[model samples]
Target: MRIAMWSGPRNLSTAMMYSFGARADFTAMDEPFYAAYLKATGLDHPMRDAVLAAQEQDPALVPLGFVQDGTRHLYMKHMAQHMIDGFPLDWAEDCVNIHLIRHPARVIASYAEKREAPRLADIGFDRQLMLFERLGGLVTDSADIRADPEGMLRRLCAAIDLPFDPAMLHWPAGPRAEDGVWAPHWYGAIHRSTGFAGPEGELPELKGAEAEVLEAAMPYYERLFAERLKNS
Candidate 1:
């Protein structure tokens, strides 16, 4: 089973990767395009060097190739925004694509906490919303996963035609193949976690400039997200 998990920043994408990686038979890759993307575009993304290093050191090359051959079960995690540069959509026709979403306010809050002056404007939420709308049925809303990881995973498995496995609910402590490259900081919570914990505290409050940016982006995203939810 080949699977691509698409999500925005701070949307539990890495956690989902951990969940999938917990499975004995599954091989997982984290944002494989990220290193190449930064290198190609010359964008000064945070932790760019580390991301490039991970790409250099990643040992899943052959496994990923096999997965692409429509053989083994593989999971690739990606950020929706990264699709802007024309990622190869046709590469995974036999693969299941899962879209992970969180409330924009919360996503912005998380991004702000992790980066310097992060804003919905900076990430181009409008463009992401448009791309997501275009993808339509290929996307899976992950907001409910916060309340019910196992149930949601089961549903996701069913959607992708895989048997639900309990092992996916509990990952071992520490990293698998996709860690240490951007670890110690980018993967702090997920690296230490064993399973999904229910949505925990209130999302950090947005204020001043950040608040303005989010407010500007909300109406458009809300409409797009609503459409996705209604159709899904």
Candidate 2:
């Protein structure tokens, strides 16, 4: 089974990827569209040149298949914003899509630390919601996963009719071969841990442009949050 896990940056996406990567039956893929996104927008993201050279810049040629002999499931970690309007999403039609969301305040706070003065588009809440509307898939909240990793994962697996794998609960700390070239800039928090961080505390404070972004993104996040899997 192929699981296309869609999420924005700084939302524990890497950790979740690691959790699934720990499974012997699954092969985790870093952002498959990063280079293509960068090439399409020509936005000067960190490690722009390196990213351009590391992965396929042509969205059409990007591989979406498992590479390992025993790999039974391919878990793709996708950034919602990377999918430009004209980019192809037909590849997702055959996969079990999952939307992973986080609070806007938390997203902006975490994202601003890496890219200053983030805009509404940068956080990708609107884009995430758009994709959800189009793809119509299961939703999971990062906060819920952090509160109870094992329980939430079991719920996730059951929701998809997949057996719960305790192996997803923990993984070797530090980077993996599947990490994207941009790992250095955005993966520090995840790299230092072996598993999901504990439950989040109070939302971070923001001001100026960042605060405005939070306000704009809150509605989108709330809409998606309402659909998130309950803590049953």
Candidate 3:
């Protein structure tokens, strides 16, 4: 199976990727389109040069097709915002796409620490909703997963008809072969962990632009959150 996990920045996307990657039958691909995003937008993101160097600069050359020789599965981790204006998304039709969301306030708070000034588009809530509307995939919340990793994951697996692999509950600390080159910049917190973190505390207070972004993102987030898999 080809699993496309769609999420924005600062969400538990990398951790989820690690969770699936821990499974013996899956080969995880981290942000396969990141370099294409950076190249097309020329956004001057951190590690821009390195990311371009490490990944396929030509989006066309990047292989989105699956060649399943046996029972192996491919879990492709994707950032919603990375689907630029001209990017093609027809590839998603063949995969079991899943949307992962976090509260906008938490996403904003965590993102600001990495990028001093962030806008609504930078965090990808808008893009996430767009994809959710079009692709209609299973939606899961990061907060929900953190609160009950095992239960929620089992529920997620059952919903997708995938076996609930116990290996998804934990992973070895540090980076893996599938990590994007930008890992050094954005994966520190996850790299140091063995599994999902505990439940998050209350949302942090925000002001100025951060607060504005949180406001803009809430409607989309709430819509997806409402569609998230029920606790089981």
Candidate 4:
């Protein structure tokens, strides 16, 4: 089974990827479309050149190839905004899609610490909602996962018709071969983590433009957050 796990940046996405990677039956894939996103938009992200050189450049073909790569179970970590430029969604029907959402306020604040400037699209809430409606798959929140990793994951597994694997709770530290080339720039904390850390602290303070972006993103976030599976 191939699972297309969609999420925004700074949303425990990598940690969740680590959870899946720990399972003996699954293989986790970091942002398979990062290179395609960069190439398509020419965004100057960290390691832009190296990422572009190392990953597939065609946005259109990347997702197709990812779903076709045979594995007992494949967990694909994806950023919703990468579906830019009218990227097709028909292929997503080929896999079991899941949405990982976080409050816009928390997402913006955590994201601002890494990159000062952020747009609504960069936070990914809007795009994520779009995909959720189109794909109609399981929806989960980062806060819910942090609050109860085992419980939330079990719910997620059951929602998708997979057995809940205890191994999803932890993994060896440091990077794995599946990490995107951008791991060095974004994965510092998770690289040291063995399991879901703890409940996230209060949303960080936001000022000026950051606050505006959060305000604009809240509706989209709420639409999906309301649909998140209830944690037992």
The model with the greatest lDDT is 3
TM-score of each: 0.82, 0.96, 0.96, 0.96
The alpha-carbon deviation from the true structure for residue 26 of candidate 1, after best TM-score superposition, in angstroms, is 1.7
Poorest stretch of ten by lDDT in candidate 1: 57-66
Runs with alpha carbons beyond 4 Å of true place in candidate 2 = 63-71
- lDDT of every model, 2 decimals: 0.67, 0.88, 0.90, 0.86
Residues 1-232, model 2: lDDT tens digits: 8898999888889999999999988888999899999999998999999999999898887854434446478899999989879898887887789999999888888887898778887778899999999989899999999999999999999999899899999988888988999999989878889888899899888988888888899898999999999778
lDDT of 3 by residue, 75-168 (tens): 9899999987768788788789899999989988998899775788898999999999988889999999999999999999999999999999
Candidate 2 weakest ten by summed lDDT: 63-72
How many residue-pair clashes does candidate 3 contain? Answer: 0
Give the per-residue lDDT digits (tens) of candidate 1, residues 150-190: 77788777766788899988887777766537666677777
* TM-score comparison, 1 vs 2, better candidate: 2
Worst 10 residues of 4 by lDDT: 63-72
